[model samples]
Target: MTGRIHRTAAGLGPAAPVRAVHLGLGGFHRSHQAWYTAGDPEWGIAAYTFRNTELPRALTEQQGVYTLLVAGEEAEVVGSLSRAHAGADRESWLADLASPDVAVLTLTVTEAAYAVPEPGQDSAVQRVVAGLRARHRSGGAPITVVPCDNVPDNGAVLRSVLRSATRDDRRFAAWVEEQVSVVSTVVDRITPAPTDEDVAAALRATGLRDEAPVRTEPFTEWLLAGDFPAGRPAWERRGARFVPDVGVYQQRKLWFLNGAHSLLAYAGLARGHTTIREAVDDDALAGTVQQWWDTAARHIALDPAEVAEYCRRLRDRFAAPGIRHQLRQIATDGSQKIPARWLPVLRAERAAGRLPGAVVTGLAAWLLHLRGGEVRDPRAAELVESAGSVRRALLALDEEVGADDELVSAVEAELHRT
Candidate 1:
């Protein structure tokens, strides 16, 4: 390798001034928001990793520059990030939030991170409350808070949690109400955790050791709803959509894209498959995944034609040969993700007096995967302890799902068949 990548060596003169602060900086953040901001000269991100210092260290070493390796295509060097910091860098974090020039704050801290925290505990909500307090005490300016996780009504979800965090401080909460604008967003991209092989490929291609290279699929889509009071980037120029409401798009993606990925992850692992391509390529698993998609589509509010086109594109994206999306990665946090991705459709189909057979199978697979003893979840104990019984597993997922004897029986039957 020639050396570590830098703005100058990567053919980028200098990154933009820091005008945005991003939390939970990971592969998806790098591949999606950072890449989108690369097209705008006015925005630069001060990215901070949630818990891992390695990513921040690497990106900081590289001067917040990294390679975006799209599957089966040439890689691009992205430099929209001005600086990187570990989450423990609270002084800098608060300073960034306090800066009047920083108008945007984005999050990709996963669906489970939005939960209100226990007293004397640190959480995503607690962190945001701290930042807002700092900003209020300094020079309070309007800032757009964007939640790019897969939760439905993500902006509302975040705002509600923030309210809980700031319940005792009505003054701070009132200031937040007057100044903060939470934008709900639907973000899509398949950025797998970079493997050693990916790092080698990057070095071979660019003659530089890219310690933090992000390998992603070619397809990327982002839809956002709500306001940016202090202004924001022209993300539409980079194919990001500003919709009147992101609810429908979120349903379409959560049920179809994320839902199907979770299916393949759980079911595919049970069937002894590895990467996403291998899992989708299995004819038997593919059929079940398609059934899940069709069933989920029946519940989304979008036009059938639009949903179908999205599914068609998803199939191609999942079958992409160059990307190595590990099943275990998507399979993490199933206790949190399954409800968001599958519960709405499951509840709807059941209410319509339909069995939703494919969902039954998906549920069975997840239960089995839980018992396999490798899942990382806040509720792992509850899930694993209940996995032996379909009823218990269903209860662990949601009380309504478990309370329904009929639904539990269906899941039980599916588990037996598997």
Candidate 2:
């Protein structure tokens, strides 16, 4: 690799004015949204990392320009971001939110980040609400807030949270109703956290040392539904789809892609596999994934042919070589992910008087993971404490699921088999 090359707007092109502000500046954002935005040089992003100062510090030093390596294909330097800020930088964030020039705000904070706050706690939703409040106070400029997280009805969820946050201020709440648009979006991309070797390979490929390069599979998709009153990027030109309703698409991706990912994270790890590609390559795990997909297809309202094509694409993504999507990484935050990823399908299947073996097996694998030791979840302590009883643990994790004796028994039976 050649000597270190610091990426900056100066090295790429003159920085565009910030027209979009993004929350949760992570690898997925760099690989997916920022890459999409890069298609239109006129639209620049001012992004903030969720909680980490390190990434922001690194990107700020590099002037928000970073390399995006599409594994086994090519590497390109992306320079769509003009500024990087810490999420805690309320002043800067508020200024951007209140700015009439910023027509759009995007978020990639995970599902858990949308959790209703405990008093005085700062959350992603809370931060957005604060920004909106600032905007409401200073001439409300209509803006679209697109939530790109993997949650069903994400737009509705964010709107609810924002409304709740400003309920005490009747004027602000009315301003939100009049001025803000919550856009639901479904984003798909297999972006693995770059390993040391991956970073080394990027340096070798590019002949320049980059501290913040992101590695991702070639496949990517973004489907959005909602209004953008102040105008937004022509993301549709860059493989993004704008639809009247993203519900079906969202459900399809959540159940098929994310649900299967969770299954692989737990079931695959139990089978001594660490990465998605390795797990999908194994016949047994691949079959289990297919079974999960079949179960999910029953509930998701979509054309069978389309769903099949999506499934095929998902399998290809999971099996992509040189992309080490880690099970441990997917396995993190199961408590938050399970609600959207698995529970809905499981409930729907049971309500129809059929047992979902694949879903049960996935849940059983998670329970086994808890017993296996060293879980990296926020609720690890509670999960581990109840690991002895599948029913107890299920209840502790989600009361609705725990209340069902048959489901709990099924999970217990599956646990024994595992």
Candidate 3:
């Protein structure tokens, strides 16, 4: 912990153990999970970005110190963040994974990282398995890999991919199958990408220019089910809920918040909107999102009242004038996201002999976004391969990527119109 940053909550007692490794050290991790970790002295996170070197360099300079501003409905919750290490220091990251001191691996690599293509039939999933195999061979400690992304059955998906990727390694494969636990989770928070102005404001608020600072809406919820082989943070203390089944909770978020977010990204973008706030403020676009949520709420497994409450909360979060979540940022990787976020309910509604109007509209917008040639995004590479066949793309997605004949036809009709 030498030269590392420390942010003490006055009278907050002792620090927790440093026992977890986070794979993607981006803004959301800084704000939500790290924020929760701040309350426990039992775990400190060692964070690694996928391939970028900028965040690590910045944090190294500041001794890994940063601040998280939880902008609430009527107030802001500002606090200093401590107990984090950068993963760019590869030796340290790998060493920690191999140590009993670290018992958990958390991931937030986003939707695309899960499905990147590789030579032959290999993909990024295989690459992750190969990495895990190497670590296992080198005496990496038994631990849990918790995926904090929005996808359903995330843990199972990862486990299948890892097993598939390492089929030849019977010994190694068995070790992973028995010892490695991949936990699925439902994570919710509305954290916008920080702008330069927002960064400056954060610095002035704390008198420190945190190169990797994070800003988020006040509401935060996490539901997880999995066991840690070694140990884990006493995160349950900070309003983190553990349950036998996180299905209902996961569905509530995926369809309402994530699904609505996609609607805003695709449909709103077509309407010349850039930021989520801009899109939500527009009557037509905002209504589109609200109406989608209305139809989607009916499909969720949770109580109608609870879904309604969640939607109300989403409105408040999206209305934040201080947040600057870009439409294009959420708009990217539609190929991966649509299957997880939107398709399930569409398929469900169609199975019940109903038209999935909002879902079809979102699918249409996504197809338009993927049509290629006009929209220029840095992440354009992911959308290129699947541009020609909407049906094939939708079908190839996971089983949970649900849609039926009527729903598919509606989307197809809309795509044709576009």
Candidate 4:
């Protein structure tokens, strides 16, 4: 901790009413949404950390103000969040939801959080259902729930989950149907967890100790498509785009950016590279990423020039020297990630009767990664046990891909190449 202290109120005016409540308060939210919200003084966010008490405690101690360190660029204190709480704070969470002022609810919880989540289980959807129930009972003011997770059709997915969660109560379900809008979003930013050096540098630069400083690449984007019934901040003024549809943009990100990232994570780890920059610096792995992007681009419906430029920018972002995005970190939760990042494209290519080499290679690398050592995944036991069967792994991930012999053979051949 540094000697100097800069309170949130010092830089920004009196704490604004909470107009947004965010789930999964991590570095990405700070670097992306909170940074955009900082552009508008009238909006303040009540952010909740995902299962971590330390971050919320630290942010609370700092008066919900922290430093944003743009890797190899600049550092600035962000004051958009007015409150921070542990995810388990039911009273505070319910109160915030019941408040009529909160018009937008954003989430950065990962994909697995929304899958068959039991009520009151550490599930993002469960928490949202509880909040929405509270809001519905308390005047049922309309709110837009924006999912910032990197899943395709995230808005619809969330709505489906909410529907299932509240299916027992027809009144609550009806209220949700009438009063809530789920917004699909395309959010991009390479926000790596800050290193000890980053913390020291922030202290040197600002003369204040920021326990929860976020370090991210300079590139950032947020595209939202949906209604905000209770209104929202002018986030568009701060680089966020409100488009009519985010499908093309979402596919571009999911396939090109996130798909390439998954490829690098598995393949790079297999090659002993730790960070994304090191992986991209390796000629073979970088070529593999490029190949994956080329194959992925075939499926996106965006303008050719835009897709090309997006791919070009993706290469630059991946090669950022200052960003130490760890491949191991990306490799975690591969079971949940691969379905969205790889399977859709792989299935589409297979349906077109063309076996995608890059997709096969990525799948093989992930299988090889499973064979490498113990991994952190919910389905780790099944993955380890099914190492010999590509069909088993694919089926375990999604039953829809049921024993596709041709696809299995392609993945096996690629696995042998590894």
> What overall lDDT goes with each candidate model?
0.89, 0.87, 0.69, 0.86
TM-score of each: 0.98, 0.95, 0.84, 0.95
In model 4, residue pairs whose N, Cα or C atoms come closer than 3 Å (at least 3 residues apart or on different chains), thus clashing, are none
Candidate with maximal lDDT: 1
Candidate with the larger TM-score of 1 and 3 = 1
Residue 351, model 4: lDDT of 86
Taking the tens digit of each residue's C-alpha lDDT, what string does model 3 give over 161-183?
67666677799888888878888
Ranking by lDDT: 1, 2, 4, 3
Q: lDDT per residue, candidate 1, 150-179, as tens digits?
A: 888999999999887887988888989889
Query: 350, model 1: CA deviation in Å?
Result: 1.3
lDDT of 3: 0.69
Candidate 2 overall Cα lDDT vs. reference?
Answer: 0.87
Candidate 2 lDDT, 123-183, residue by residue in tens: 8887888889888878999999999999889999988888777888898899898889999
Candidate that beats the other on lDDT, 1 or 2, i.e. the better one = 1
Model 1 spans with C-alpha error above 4 angstroms? none
